[model samples]
Target: MVLKIALIGAGLIGREHAKLISSNPRVQLEAVADISEAGKVLADEYGTRYFFDVREMLDATKPDGVIIALPNAFHAEAAMACIERGIPSLVEKPVADTLEAAMQLTEAVERKGVPVLVGHQRRHSPDIAKARQLMNEGALGRLVAVNAMWLTDKPTNYFDAAWRRQPGGGPLLINLIHDIDCLRFICGEIESVMAFSSNEVRSFEVEDTASISVKFTNGALGTLLMSDTAVSPYNWDTAAGQALYFPHQPENTYVFAGTKASLALPLMDFWRHENENSHWQHPLLRQHITLDGSRAYENQLHHFLDVIEGKAEPIVSVRDGMLTLATILAITKAGKEGRIINVADMLG
Candidate 1:
């Protein structure tokens, strides 16, 4: 049976969701809600209803599930509407624009016991899921240190939106938040962060580059470098060949070093000595980790279907998304203040 799904927003990602929902046999695009005519056009294309307000769409269409792809600030409001109607929803990443907003929505969902999945779609990628499985199985064996990168170049007009020139719209939240979420997913909770940021290239008040130091609650440490004004394909979106829009560039963007061995992601190369208990002086051997050969977005939609059916739980819940947002916020605060910021303190 095809489940009817509605979408909020008609922007880039909202369009992507429309296409994805249309393509899935298990789901149908029931309606679209946006304040723009684009929403009407998209609904016409998909043979679905259109509404200027998400609440009106929800009340009229009463979809089995909703996908909120609106701007960050509207995420909570849209998802709350879904929860109010006792409908499950997939709220696109960051969960909300502010930590408080996220908590508010999270509290409502928890109280009502209405399932709302936070869209950190990368977590659904085969490689990311495999990494977490490997870590859990002690394949990495006591995570020690890690390194990651997300350097890329965006066209000048990409920042034409005024918000992109401001702090919240920069790569830290716009791009690097994925990396931060992946790190937290693969490694563990981020305890604190210290960073150095600059806006020299774009100089639009938002940082164009940053270097981050991370300390995990589990005692693992990691480093990350990010930029949207640089020319490089060392980011997971490209390197993993899993992202929807980017051309595939096979490379390793993250490396996890542990007491027993080391692992490089997207490449899935596991490195360790010929002997398990060998010292660093010994030569290292390489092995590849096998994956299920699935795509991220598709898997995410399938999982959302499962969540709506009460057959699965959300992998990235709202509270969990808050932690990721808080961690990134900590990095932002750290860079701005020139001091270490604790992730937990950000919630208080």
Candidate 2:
């Protein structure tokens, strides 16, 4: 059975989600809502219903599932409305602007007993999946440390969208959250975090560069580095050179160091490691696991459809969203305060 979908927000990410949903035979894009006329244009292009208000869309075309891809600040409000109506929803990344908002939305979803999935599409990437599998299978035995880096060349078009420059929508929430959530998926829970950021070289109010360090509950340490000021491309370099097939904007890289072995992957390189008898000469198996065939957005849409069909568990629940958002908020707070912040404290 094809699951009907209602998409909220007509921005780049929302349109990407809509394209994926519409193309899937198991899913149908039924409606779209955005406050801008661009929403109507997208709806017309896709031959789906369009609305200027979310409430009006909900009233007019009641879809089986909704994908909320609005601005970060609008996530909680939009998600709460859908949950109140008992409609399963897939909210885009970061979930909300603040930890308090994330918690409230999570509570609303729990109270309504509706499935709420956050759109952390990295979890659906095939290369990431393999890495996760390897981690689970002890390929990286007793992980020791993880280092992640994502540097991008921000074109003028990035600033073309006024909201992208605002306080709540900078590199941390907009881009780095993917890495943070993916790290959690592979490395385990983060106990505490310290972050430093700067707005240098970018014509925005929010920081364009950020460095974060995490203390995992598993006793593993992690360092995450992100910058939008990178004049030269990084994702593409990783995708082409490392042959790590990432879906879109292929510019992130990761290096995982384990007690038994260590491996470095650019973007989404999912390779196994060969353990040596001696600890000094640990060698990594040079098998490049490519997942360029499937787009993360498409996989995420299918997962949402499965949730609506009652055939699978949500890949990213509202609870997961809360936790990830809380972690990011903690990092950002720490960066601002120049102190380490406990992830547990942000949960409250």
Candidate 3:
């Protein structure tokens, strides 16, 4: 049986979700809800009903599941609506604009026993899954250090949106959040964070670049560099070829160093001493781990379908998304205060 899916919001990401849903033979785009004309245009294009109000669409269409891709500010409200109606939902990440709202949404989902997934789609990537497996299997030995980068140059026109230049719309929230989530997914919980951010390049209200230091609960150390004004290919999107808009670059953006070996992400290069000794005196060998190129979004959509059918639990639950958000928010707070922020305390 085809699951009927309703989509909230018609922005770029929302449209992408709609396209994916429509392309899936197991799901049907039953309706769409958005405050703008784009919603109706998208609905008409996809041969689905459209409504300006979420309540009206939920009441009328009675979709089997919902996909919420509204702005960060609206995520909680829309997600709560779906939860209240017992409709399974897949919400785009950061979950909500604030930690408080995300907590409330997760609480409501628990109370209602509704299934909800967060769009940390990277977890669905075959490369990431394999990396996690290898880490768990001690292929990377005792993970000691990690380094990641998300440097890119955005076009001037990309900042034309008023929100894009606002405090919450910079590279930290807009881009770095994904990296934070991936780190947490592959490594473990973040214990604390310290960061320094700057808007010197654009001098906008939002930060254009940031350097972050992280302490993982498992006693691992990590550093991350993020910028929206750099013309480099050291980011997941560019390196992984996940998004078609960016030209794919053959380079790894993350490096994981462990006691036994080190690994470079996306490129899937594993480095270790030719002998098990793993000492400075030994020759290091590089082995490239092959990956089956899979589309994360498509895999995510299929997982959501499994969730709606009660066949599987969410890969990224609401609470997990909140934790990721707390980590990023702590990074932002650390940058602002010029001190380390405890992620656990911030979550509480």
lDDT of 2 by residue, 1-348 (tens): 777889999987787777777668888889989999989999999998889989889878888989998988899899888887888889888889888888888788777778888988878877677678878988778899999887877777868878789888888888888888988998888999998989878757888898899999999999988888885455422442422233344544778888755555544444444535554445456655555666566677778888887888788888898888888888889989999999999876
Compose the digit string of candidate 3's lDDT tens values, residues 217-247. Answer: 9999999999999999999998998863678
lDDT of 1 by residue, 1-348 (tens): 899999998988899999899889999999899999999999999988899977888998889999998877788988999999999999998798889898898899899999999999999999999888889999878999999999999998877767778856778988899999999999989999999999888778889999999999999989999999789989999999998888999999999999888999999999998877789788899999888889999999999999999999999999999999999999999999999999989999
Report how far off residue 56 is in candidate 3 (Å): 0.6
RMSD of each: 1.1, 3.1, 1.1
TM-score for every candidate vs. truth?
A: 0.98, 0.91, 0.98
TM-score (C-alpha) between model 3 and the true structure: 0.98
Judge candidate 1 against the unseen true structure and give its global Cα lDDT, from 0 to 1. 0.91
Error of 2 at 286 (Å): 3.6
Q: Candidate 3: lDDT of 195? A: 96
Q: Runs in model 3 with CA error above 4 Å?
A: none
Full-model lDDT for every candidate:
0.91, 0.80, 0.91
Model 1 spans with C-alpha error above 4 angstroms = none
Q: Is candidate 1 or candidate 2 better by TM-score?
A: 1
